[model samples]
Target chain A: MNQTIIQEVRETTPLIHHLTNQVVMNFSANGLLSFGAAPVMAKAEEETAEMAANANGLLLNIGTLTSQELPAMINAGKTANERGIPVVLDPVGVAATPFRTNAVKRILSDVQPTIIKGNAGELAHLVEIPWETKGVESVGDGNADEIALKVAETYQSAAIVTGKTDVICIGSEVVHNHTGHPILGKITGAGCLLGSILTACLTTNKSIEQQALTAVQFYGLAAEYAAERPDVNGPGTFLSHFIDALAYDPAKLERE
Target chain B: MNQTIIQEVRETTPLIHHLTNQVVMNFSANGLLSFGAAPVMAKAEEETAEMAANANGLLLNIGTLTSQELPAMINAGKTANERGIPVVLDPVGVAATPFRTNAVKRILSDVQPTIIKGNAGELAHLVEIPWETKGVESVGDGNADEIALKVAETYQSAAIVTGKTDVICIGSEVVHNHTGHPILGKITGAGCLLGSILTACLTTNKSIEQQALTAVQFYGLAAEYAAERPDVNGPGTFLSHFIDALAYDPAKLERE
Candidate 1:
């Protein structure tokens, strides 16, 4: 992926509207701001559609979904679709409960996200592939690339499955990113922040496949940079350094 | 304030159940964990009461209030009250919208929080004191100590108003803490995370006023420590070091 995309994000400062989970909003917003993207979180059903219409991109995450947020998510997704702004969906813990699975199914059918991002287990669940999930963490072992490809084909959107090896698929073309660290999983909102980053990346005039791959690669590399810092002894410290890494020079990051 | 309270919090590892806003949940949980407290976030009405019953303390923050979460907050607060577990209320953005103001009033009447935490604007709004607020931020300048004292007297509970100087009041006694930094206002959830920490501190066997004051001082000292770090050039890096400082030794913090 061209590193210029990061520069583009910084220059543009795209406004991305998020109708995401309660657990990850602050991290997601801070991460977006660090990546040089403006994030606006509006969940009130009365204002979500307008927020989405005004944004350059929209992200829908169901990590800690409530009955009230479900409609707002749907409304924002539909408005983003109508406005021609890219919508990225993170199907967090879809296999954890019937309520979540049904919600994702409804979102997929009604909103039609431009890019669908999740872990192997979440992506597999979306495609009706049997997978074991414990709460929001993906535990099942499966061919992540195949699952991502299948989901992309089914939804007719770009698919990104992140893990030790991040997989991105648009139609039949696939790319793998091996830049992130194991510590990424230790902190909550790491995946959710990635979804926000991808939403920001989607605002740029790039192909869906390239945009998703770039986002995964950028986030993974930042995690690697943060994990190597002397100050980052644990997940708590890693969070601070990771945000700093997001705002680091893309050219310098690419050189490293 | 007795510094031993910090050691008690570390030894107890109190489980704090949070019914907080969507924006600050992840940070609040991480902050609580960094301070040697177990954090549990449960919002579903069906399970919140049981969760509250099992927790050592409960925190209710109405930062991103939705119609669905209002009832759950009430239920959890009532359950905590019934179980005699301390409930701390962060009346976030109550002055910004009537929806939030009404929800806070309902919770105040029904749940009866053990300690009420907010900025001067939020506390003032609780008593129908006119104050200008921009979104969740407190913009109006007023006597924070007076407002805190009035709120505490009216509710017959401890009241904490946090800003450049943190103020805690219970009955006729009032204590002012000049430990926090200006950089705190730049980050989202800085106040909300304080509510979580205060909740954890409440689980210790200390007076309500002392518990609130110690939490504020400890957090402010952590922020000071984080700001002094070599890598902490801005809010992004400051956040990382702050988490590490939360887990730092109380003796070391005192020496500095």
Candidate 2:
């Protein structure tokens, strides 16, 4: 992945419309802002489509699925589709409840997102693969790269299955990112924030595979930087330092 | 305010059900947890009442009001009232739009919250006092103590008006807390997080005025401690440090 994607995101400051869950909206917005992208959250059915039409990209997350928000998500997704703006879907906790699984199916059938992002359990649920999920957290392990590739192939969208090893798949190409820390999982919204980063990166003209790879790599690098800080004794302090790391120059971090 | 209120909150670990905006859910939940309160967010109209009934307290915030969430908020509020669990209301962005203002009125008339929490601009809007509000942030100056007193008397509830000086009022009695930092305003949900903290505090057997006062003072002190950290250079760092400070013992901080 080209490091220039990060620079491009900073320069463009793409306006991203987020129809996300209540659990991670503030952190996702703040994370996007730290990465120099503008974030606008509009969940009202009355305004979501218009907001999506005006935005450079759209992110749809279903962590806190509500019956009322389903239509707004579909509407915003369709609008982003119409505008040809990239849409990233974070199927959060899809295995947690039947409501979430149905909602993800509804969105997949209607919106046709440009990228589908989820953890291994969520991705398995998306593809009907057996995996143990304790609420939103994936407890059982699986081949992330294979799952990402299968989901991308089945849905015809770029897929990112995140875990200890982050897997990004677009068509036949697959990549892995292993720069994140365990503390990243201790805080909420780490994966949700990654979806926002992907939305910003997708706004650029990079290939879908490159866009997915760049977002995953950049986010993991930021988490690593934050975890290494002396003041970041735990997840609480790491949350703030992670934001600071996002705003820091990516060039300063050690490269693979 | 008795400093022992903090010790009580830590002992109770009250479960708080939040029907809040998407903008501040994660931060509020994390803040509550750091203060030794268990936080649960349920916005679906189907489950809100059940969740509220099970919780020790409930919080209703209107920062990102949607037509769908209105019914859920009302249901949860009524259930919490019926259960005799304290419900805290944060009339966020009440002056920014009529939709929000009318929603606040509806909740106020229906919920009968035990505590009404907001900034000066929001509190003023509740009682029809003219004040300038730039979105959710208060821009106009007003007597927070006077506004808080009026709101509390009119609604028959404790009122907390937070600003450079935090005001807590129950009936005719009003108190001021001078502990928070300016950077609290720089973050998205500083006021909203305080509402959650108040919810946890109200779960104790303390008087309404003392509950409000203790919550305001404790939150402000945490913000001040967070701001004093050497690694905390700006709002991003302050956010993480604030959470850390919330988890820190107040006796450890330098006494004024």
Candidate 3:
């Protein structure tokens, strides 16, 4: 199922509209491009609705949510929801501050996301449960896996908790655990890009189960390939190779 | 004066706060680095004011303005103003659409920019005068030089109009006319990057006059060098070469 979706991603090349933070904008766009998706970063309230309605899928990221961007996200997400386009929400830093939490709540109220991807702490908070969170990193007590399932059930959306390993769940079912490279955390935008790649998968396939598994597998595989490159000069070099790996032929993954 | 500013840019390497669009974030960040400046893209309202206050300059670009980004821009711009840090505004597509124009006006009224950079049509519309604009390109009744001067005077800020030749103005002076290659337009983010480079120059130098000249001269020289590379296959190659040229030794600009 994973390989099939990867093949579809290569073939269809969906256009993904991202309303993301300024810090990760470029990386997200390039990451999407590498995975055979055309990325459009449109944040204006006026045009965002139009762009979202036209896109194959929409990813709403509040990593750098500002006052104006909040409205644009709501407008774009609403339009995407109305148009029957899949919406992926990355409530970046939601557990870190009140502003972020409120913004996430507002987005949730406005758009029924197909998937909500975040660290363990953010997910726990969004689901109104007590969990540990440390500066955008997931380091918490309680059953993160169980909490993820609860959040997914509560929101009626798939939940993704990314850390050393990524866990995706819906309701009581633990979907997939994708072991990605440790180096992925060293680079910025890894999580944001994952959200984008998931959008690509959602556009091509109907099953959330298949999309979640394939996205994690393909992303982890790409990171593995990047780690294998000669002279892996930390995050900078890893960032370049990660993109290259994503753009690399899917046949290469099979051979590996 | 220009030489003094260039030396200071190399020496100080001031951090610039960018609350900009997503399309050119990488190019802007890399360009600032190449020109010996630290670029921090902070759009989250939670941290934008802090970033702006700490940084030496602020650049607010609406190239991909989302509703969420507007508040961050306002927060950062207000903080930058209070801290006496120079702020540069690039009103991309201001003349082309009402959404863009209203945003530009709001930013202008809120921030009181130190410099306003755009093409002829953008500048014309910014000053409330009608002018023809075609998808980021401008071809109108007025001369580029005159339009640049007029806009500078109207804004009471330095205005830069880049085209076949880059024309910069402080009021009506038309201070610099930097002849540059046309191929620069083929690549995206050239103008967005110019704003970043200018922010670096302004933060390093004492006066905006010398900073403007150095910014235009250095950017033009880099473009000229990139245009000469034999392997310039397309826009992608051009972008890579542009970065390479920016990081190249300042001695390379001797001929141009």
Candidate 4:
């Protein structure tokens, strides 16, 4: 475990500016708060640019993209890039519709994201790789490693591919995270919550890859703890415990 | 408790179309699902009318509303009205800003909501009643009864004023619910989740007030059940247990 990154995030409580999908705003905000970071969800075009400029990290997600938010997302991303702050982009359900794909493309063309995160199918679409996809669920039985590598090389940014075994790639280097529970799949916005916390993690002076790795491992560990609770009988129970685990003291997260 | 409404919602599994705010979409969807209602969140202007027209109920929430969605919300509400399905309006945080207030007013003018739900502050603003408010929290010490009654009279729709105690007013009759937990106040979308379930409950053959009472009673009971769980410690745990309790068989929920 990269305790330094976790410690840094907790101590600093970085402010994360989110122009994320509407579906996960509350969860993302709560998750970030639980993880000891400040979250500000502002997508209005009138204030996004200014908000992004001041935030320690910026996250842009397209889970519920509309034509109207593209300009605001781009403006925020551009401002984050200019400030040299980390910008994490989660191109959720990019392959589900042309409007989503086109919107992601527009954001990509204008902003140099520091880290790009998505499931394998969504990442495959980003790098133009052939991977079976159905409404952002499956990464399928393709070369997930190749897809992650391609996404890393194509986007010129670190890529995190979340699935049964999460894969993260930055340039030629790659890391795999296997500490997770399947309950995360049953709940919505597990990945979105991860993206939000990742934004905060990357704000530390640590390497983006190191920060991403620590964040992923810590998140999965939290899920594991949450799911293992005796009262956590289903997705609903696990969801609540997961939030509590995020706020749990990392030093006390030892497994039995 | 009206067990019939719960049975009807579980049996029919009504399809609820939600044009709600981004902050609570996931929670509302999951909560509604847990309550035996299917939630479909669609806000695109192009498809909202079609979606709402086909749904058993429609929910319009303006928590984090944007300028682009007012037309879509109005269109969906109008469609629901044309089909004679219930439209549940949650004017969340309307007093915070003019954009939110104006958007709710616009939807109110174009669409006849069958049940208008809000905190006393929001509902008071709707009825042109004065109440102290900051953002979306307080109902203060105002005449919440008058606020609910005036809103019911003014909109010609049932009004629900939610605060420490929830007041439901339909025409001249008003009912107060006393079955919730203080922990509900700590969560972000407790009210929004109630509105979604209320939409589903209103779809039954029973009178609107009966269904509303049942929904409110069942929701508050679920919160109480969840909050009393031995393992539940805070809002995070309460949230998850609340969802589980929403799905719990009513027969099994009786306290010791």
Ranking by TM-score: 4, 1, 2, 3
- Kindly report which residue stretches of model 3 are placed more than 4 angstroms away from their true locations once superposed: A1-13, A44-47, A66-69, A141-144, A170-173, A253-256, B1-26, B32-61, B66-98, B101-191, B194-242, B249-256
Docking level for model 1 = incorrect
Q: Please, what's the RMSD in Å of model 4? A: 6.2
Model 2 C-alpha lDDT versus the unseen true structure:
0.84
Q: How would the docking of model 4 be graded?
A: incorrect
User: Taking the tens digit of each residue's C-alpha lDDT, what string does model 2 give over A136-232?
Assistant: 5677986788888889999999888898988888887888888788766657688889999999999987887777888888788889888887877
Note the residue pairs that clash in candidate 4.
none
Give TM-scores of chain A for all candidates: 0.97, 0.97, 0.95, 0.97
Span of 10 residues, lowest total lDDT, candidate 4 chain A: A132-141
Report the candidate with higher TM-score, 2 versus 4.
4
Highest TM-score scorer? 4
Write model 4 residue lDDT over B1-256, tens digit each, in one string: 6788889888887888888877788989788877887776756675568767668999998887878778889888998999999999999888878888888889988999999998888888887777778877664687888999999999999999887788999999999988788899899899999999899999999988898888888888888888888878999877878888887666656562
Please provide, for model 3 over B1-256, each residue's C-alpha lDDT reduced to its tens digit, 9 standing for 90 to 100.
2666767877888999998777787788988898788899978879999999999999998888856678889889888889889999988877655777777777878887888888778887876667885434465766777777777777788888777667788866776556466756544577888899888888863667778877888788888888777765334345667787876555666464
State the weakest 10-residue window (summed lDDT) of model 4 chain B. Answer: B247-256
Please give, for residues A40-79, the per-residue lDDT of candidate 3 as tens digits.
Answer: 6766778778777767899998887887668889988998
> iRMS of each prediction in angstroms?
3.7, 3.5, 5.2, 3.8
lDDT of 3 at A33: 69
The second chain of candidate 4 has a TM-score of: 0.97
Could you give candidate 2's per-residue lDDT for residues B1-256 as a string of tens digits? Answer: 5677878988867778888887778888777777777676756676678767777899998888888789889998998889899999988888888899788888888888998888899999888888898967888997887899889988998888888888888789888899889999789898899989889989998887788887888888888888988878999888888887787677765363
